[model samples]
Target: MKRSHSNTGANPDVRVRMRRLRWTTFSLVAASYMLAFFHRMAPAAIASDLQLAFDASATALGALAATYFYVYTLMQIPTGILADTLGPRRIVTLGGAIAGVGSLLFGYAVTMTEASIGRMLIGLGVSVAFIALLKINAAWFHDRHFGTMVGLTLVLGNIGSVMAAAPLAWVLQFTTWNTVFIVLGGVSFALAVLTWLFVRDHPGEAGLPSLREMDGHEAHPPHEGHWFEGLMTVLRNRYTWPIFWMNLGIGGSFIAFAGLWAVPYLSDVYGMERVAATQHTSLMLAGFAIGAFSVGVLSDRLGRRRPALISTAFVHLLCWLPLVFALPMSLAMSYSLFLLMGLSAGSFTLSWACVKEVNPHALSGMATSVVNTGVFLGTGILQPLVGWTLDRAGTAQGAAAQYRLGILIFFFCVVVGFVGSLRVRETYCRYIS
Candidate 1:
C-alpha cells in the first residue's frame, strides 16, 4: 500500500507539525467526550431541583438520569458502525450538533416528558463520541499508545464528571440549571465546528501515512466488511464475553454511583449537605480520572492486561463490601472509600484496549463498542433496580435501611463482573496469542 505524506510532501517542518496536529485533534474530540460526561452526571447535581420541578419520585428520578444510558446503551453497536464507516470527523460533528440541541431542550424544559426527551437526545448524540474518539486514537497513534491514550481521553472526559459534581452545585447557586445547560449547548455547537475543521479519520486523509505504516507495519487500513460477519466474529470470540460482563459490572457500578446515586446516598445515609455531598462525590470522580490515566500508562509499560484487570476488579469488589453492608465509618473514611472505589472502577478502561487488541484490526471500533455497551447496560439496569428496591420499602429518597437489598444486588453485579474479569484470556496487548 502507498503511504500518506504531509500536505507539503512530507516537509520536515510540516511532518513535525503533524504530530502537534494529532494532539490538537485529540483535544477537540476529548472536549466532546467531556461534554457527554457532564450530561451523564449532571442529574446527580440537580436531582433535588428536578424533584421539586417535576415532583418526580426516586424511581422516576432514576429513570430520568437513566434515560441517557438507555439510549446510549442501544447506540453502542451502531455507533461503532458509524465510527468505522462514516469516520470520526463526520460522526463527532453530527453528534456534537445533536447534543447541542439536546442540551438546549433539557435546560429549558419544564415537564418531565420534555426533560426526558432532552436527556434521550443528549444520550443519542453523545453516544457517538467516545467510540469515535477511540477510532481516532487507533488510527492516529501507534498501537502501543492505545491504552495510555484511552486512559488519558477518559481523564479529560471525567473532568466533565468532576464539573457535574460540586462545581455544578456551586454554579446552580448563582444561575439556574436551565442557564447552565443552555451555555453547554452553545459550547457543544462550537466544538462541532472545530472538529469538522480539524479532525482527520486517519493520517492518510491528512496527507500523512498511517502510524502503523510509519512504524514499519506497512499495512493498509483494514477494510470494513459485512456488519453481520464482523459482529458475529466478535461475538463468537471467547474473550469478548468476559470483558463485556466485566465492563457491565465495573463500568455500570461506577455510572450508577457517580452518575446518579452517590450524592443522594451521602445525603440520606450520612446527612451531608448538598454541596458537601457532591464534594465527596467529586473526590470519587477525581480518583477515577487520575486512576484511568495512571493505570493505563502502567498497563502499557507492563504489557499485561489480565493481571491489571483482575487486580483492580478484586479491589473494587472488596470496597463494595462496606457499602453493601452499610458499614459505619468516620467522614474521612467514607471519603477515602469513595476515592478508592473510583480508582478501581476506572481500571475498566483497560477492557477497551483489551477488546480492541483481541479483535481484527479493522474492526477495532466495532469491537470497542460491543464491550462499551455493557457499561451503559449495567447502569441502565442497576440504577432503576436501586430506585425500585427503594420504592418497595416505601422510601423514595433511599434511606440507609431501604438501600440494604439494593446494595446486595449491586454487590451481586460486582461479584459477577469480578469473576468474569478473572476468566478473561490474557491478550498481552496484541491481536494474536
Candidate 2:
C-alpha cells in the first residue's frame, strides 16, 4: 500500500506562496481548458445557426463539428508525451494560442471547408488542455488531494460547458455565432499570456518542497528520465485497455450526445423550442459539473475507486433506458433523466485517477493521454457516424425517429464501456508504484 504525502512541510510564508502558485498556475491552465471545453461543445448550441449559415446537411454539420475531435484524437498521444517531457507550461500556453487562432478562423468561416479548417485548428489547440491540466494536478497537489483536484479541474472546465449551454443560447438571440466565437478566441489568447506569465509545473520551481520530499510520501517510480520508456510502460499495463474502452464508451457517448446531438434530439423528438432544449442540455452539463466534484470527493473520502466508478456506470447506464426506448415522458421527466445521465457520465473522470494510481508515477501524463485518446477517438467517429445515420435514415418525417435511433446506438456503446470497466483492476487509492 502506498502512503500519503504531506503538503505542509514548507514554512507558513513559503507554504502560502506555494498554495498561491498552485492555484494561480492551475487557474491559468484550467481557464484554457475551459475554453477547450467550450469549443468542444459549442456546436450543440448553434447547430441550427451553423446549418443555416452554410446550408449544410446534418452530416455536413456533424463533419464540421467532428473536425475538432479528428485533430484532437490524433494529437492525444503526442500531446501526452509533450506534457510529460516539454511540460504543461509550454504545452498549455502553446495550446491556448492555437485554440484562439482556431476560434477566430471558425468564427469567420463563410464556407464549409473553411469552417472545417477552423474546427481542425480548434481541435488541435484545445487537445492539449485536458492532458496538460492533469499533469499540472499531478505535480502540485498531494496524492490524497489528487482526485479531488482533478474533479475540481473538471468542474472548472465544465464551467465552459455550462457557458456553452443556456448562456450561449441566450447570447445567440442578440449576436451572431461568429461574433461570439471571435470573442471567445480573444479570451483564449489572453489566457495564454496569463499562463505563460504565472504558471510553473512543479512546486520546487516555486521554491517549495516537492510532494515526494514531504512526510508520508509512499509511492516511487521504478524508473524515470527515459521519455518513451515511461509511455511504453503505461501502454503495456493490462488494466489500461479496459479503461480505454470504458473511456471510448462513456466519454465518447457523452461527447456524441452533449457535444452535438442532444439539443437537436430534444427539439426534434419532443418539439422543444431551442431555448427550452438548451436549458435541458444545460441542466445535464450542470449535473455533470457538480457530479465530477461530488464523486471525486466521495472517492477520496472512501479511498475506493472501482466500486464508486462501477456504481456510477450502472446509474449512467440506466439513464439511457428512457432514451433508448423513446419512452414517453413529460418535459420534467426528460430533464430529470438528462441531468441524471450527466451526473452518471462524470464517472469517466474517476478513470483518470485510476489510471494515474496504477501506472508509474512519472508517467501520469502519458497514461492519461493514452486513455484520453480513446475518448476523442470515440467522439471523432461517433459524431459523424450518428450524423451519417441521421442523413441516411430517409424521409423528412422519419428524421426525428432516426435521430432517436442514433442515440439508442450510443446507449449500447455506453453499456459496453461500463462492462469493460468492471474488468479493470481496482486501485483503492494506492499506486502500484
Candidate 3:
C-alpha cells in the first residue's frame, strides 16, 4: 500500500517535468523558426539598400533574393527525410549553426555572387526548421491538437516576418542592413546552443511516457519500412499532390510578394516612403499570423477541413483582384486590402494539416515536406519572374503600369490555389486511410 502511494505521487512529478521539458524544447525550436522567417522576408525591407550596396538591377536583385527559395525548395524533401530519421533536436541544432555561419557570410559579402552563396547556405540550413518543427509537434502534442500547435507555431514564426518588415525598415534608419544580419547570425548561434542543451526529440528521450501512453492509449507505431520506401509511398499517394499544388499557388505567391516585391511595388507605384511601404507588409504579415491561428483552432473545433479552406481561399482569390487591377485606394483602404489579402492567404497553413492527415502517420515529416516544397518552388519561380517582367516593362511604362503585369501574375497563381482547395480530400481532421 505504501509503495502504491509513492508511485502515484511520483507520477505527478514526472508529468510536470515532462510538460516543462517539452515546452522548453518547443520554445527553442520555435525561436530558430523565427530566424528562418526573418531571413526570408528581410530582403524586401532592404531592397533599395541592397541595390545601392551591390549596384544591382531589378532582375539581379530578384535573383539574389530568390536564391534562398531555390535552395530551400530543393532541401524540403531531404530535410523531411532527415527529420524523420535523425530526429528534430540534432537536425535543428545543426541547421541553426549553419544558418548562423551563412548569415555572417551574407553580412560581410562584397559582391552579389558572394551574397547569393551566403543566402543559399542560409536557405539550406533553415530549410530544416519547419519540417523539424512539425515532427517535434507530432511527438510532443496530442493528435487532436496538432492543427492548433501548427497554427501557433506559424503565428510565432511569423513574428520574425513582422520584424523583417516595418521594424526592419525602422532599424535600418539607425544601422546598416549588414549590421542586422550579423546580429541575427549571433542570435542563431545562441539558439543552436540552447536547443542542443535542452531539446529532446520526444517525451521518451526525456525519460517520460509518450503522450499516447500517458493517456492510456497505444503509442503510434514506429515506421518499420525503410525511409526511402516511406517517402516513395507519400509521393505515390494521390491525396498528397493537391495540397502541394495548393501551396504552390497560395504560399508561393504570398511569399514572393511579401518576401521581395511588396515594398518595391508600393514604393515604385505609389510613391510611398520606405517606412510607409513596410507598414503595409507588416500588417499583412500580422494578419497572416492571426489567420493561421484562427484557421487551425476553427478547423480542429469543427472537425472539418474543406469548408474553412475553401471559404478562406475564395476570399483570398477576391483579394488579389483589386491589386491586379490597380484599383484606386486611400492609405486606410490600402492597409485594409493588404490585411484582408494576408488573412485570406492564411488558409494556406491548413495545407500542412490536410496533407499530414491523409498520409501515413509515421511519414508526417516527409508528407508535409513534400507539400512545403511547393511553396518555395512557387516563390523561386515567381520572384524572378516578377522582376523579369518589371524589367521588361521598362521605364517606358509609368511605375503604376509597370507593376500591373506582375500583380496579374500573382492573381493568376491565387486563382489556381483556390481551385486546388476544392479538390483536397476531407480527412475530418484525422488519418483517413
Candidate 4:
C-alpha cells in the first residue's frame, strides 16, 4: 500500500506525540464514562433512602430507578447515530453537561416527580457516553487491539460502579445521599469541561495518521452514505439481531439486579444490613470489572469470540440457580456466588465486539448501539416488572418468597441470554463486513 501523506515521513517524535494526545483524549472521555456507571448503579446502595425521601412503594421505587433505563433504552440508537455523525467529542461533552445538570437536580429534588425527571435526564445524558466511547476506541486503536481497549474502558468505567456500591453505603453512614449526588454533579460538570478541551474524535482530527496508517496499513475510510443508511445496513444484517437478544437477556438482567435490587434482595432475603449487603454488590461489580477486562484480552489472544461468550453465559446462568431457589447460603457462599455471577456476567461485554466485528467498520457505533439498546430495554422492563411481581406477591408471602419470585424473572432472562449465546456467530476477532 502506498503510504498516505498523513503517514509518510511520520517520525518517532510525531508518533510519540500522537500516543500522548490519544491517551489524554481517552482519559477525559473515560472519566465521563465512569460517572455514567456510578449513576447507573447508585440506586441500589441508596434504595432505602429513596423510599423514605419520596415515601415511595417498592413499585414506585423500581419505577424511579427504571426511569434511567427507560431513557437509556430510547436513546441508544440516537446516540449511536450522533456518535457517527456529530463525532464522539461533541456528543460526550454535551452528554456530560446534561448528566451534571440531571445529577444536581436529582440531588436537590424534594418530590417524587422531581426525582423521576432528574433520573430520566441522567439516563438521557449518560446514554451517549458508551457508544461515543466505543466509536473513539474503534477510531484510535488498531483493529487487532479493539477488544483489549474496550476491556480497559470497561475496567475503568466499572470503577464508578465499584464506588457506587459498598463505598456509597459506607459514605451514607456520615453523609446524606443528597450531598453525594450534588458532589457527583459537580464532578460531571468538570468532566464536561475537560472533554471539550481535550478530546478529539480520532487522530485525523489532531492532524496525525490513523493507527493503521502508522502500522503500514491503509486507514478505514470514513462513512460515505447518510447516517440512516448506515444504521439500516447494520439493522438489516442477520448477525446483529442475535447480539441484541443476547444483551437483553444477560446485560439487562445484570444491571437490573445490581442497579437497584441486589442490595434489597440481600437485605430482605438474608436479613443483612445495608452496608453488609453493599459489600456483596461491590464484590460483584469488582468481579464484573475484572472479568470484562480479562474476557476482552482473552478473546483477543484466543483469536475467537464464541467459546468464551458461551462458557461465560453458561456459568452465569448456573450461578443464578441458588437465587431462584432461595437456597440457604453461608456468608462465604454468598460472596462467592455474587462474584462468580459477576464474572460470568462479563460475557455480555463480548457482544459489543461481536456486533462491531460482524458489521461494516464505519458503522461500529451504530452496530454496538443497536445491541446496547437491548441491555437497557431489558433492564427497563425487568426492573419494574420485578417490582410489580414483588408488590403483587406482597409481604403476606414474606420477603423471601417475594424476592424469590422477583429473582425468577432474572433467571428467565439468563436462560434467554444463554440461548442467544449459543446462536452467536464466531468472528475470529476481526471485522467480517
What lDDT does each candidate get? 0.87, 0.86, 0.91, 0.91
lDDT of 1: 0.87
TM-score of each candidate? 0.96, 0.96, 0.97, 0.98
Model 1: per-residue Cα lDDT over 217-300, one tens digit each: 556446667877887888898888889998998889888878888888888887889998999888999899988888789888
Deviation from truth (RMSD, Å), model 2: 2.7
When 2 and 3 are scored with lDDT, the better candidate is 3
Off by over 4 Å in 1: 1-11, 395-398
Candidate 2 whole-model C-alpha lDDT, 0 to 1: 0.86
Higher-lDDT candidate of 1 and 3: 3
TM-score for predicted model 2 compared with the true structure: 0.96
Between 2 and 4, whose TM-score is larger?
A: 4
What lDDT is obtained when candidate 4 is compared to the true structure? Answer: 0.91
Superposed on all Cα atoms, the candidates' RMSDs to the truth, in angstroms, are 2.2, 2.7, 2.4, 1.5
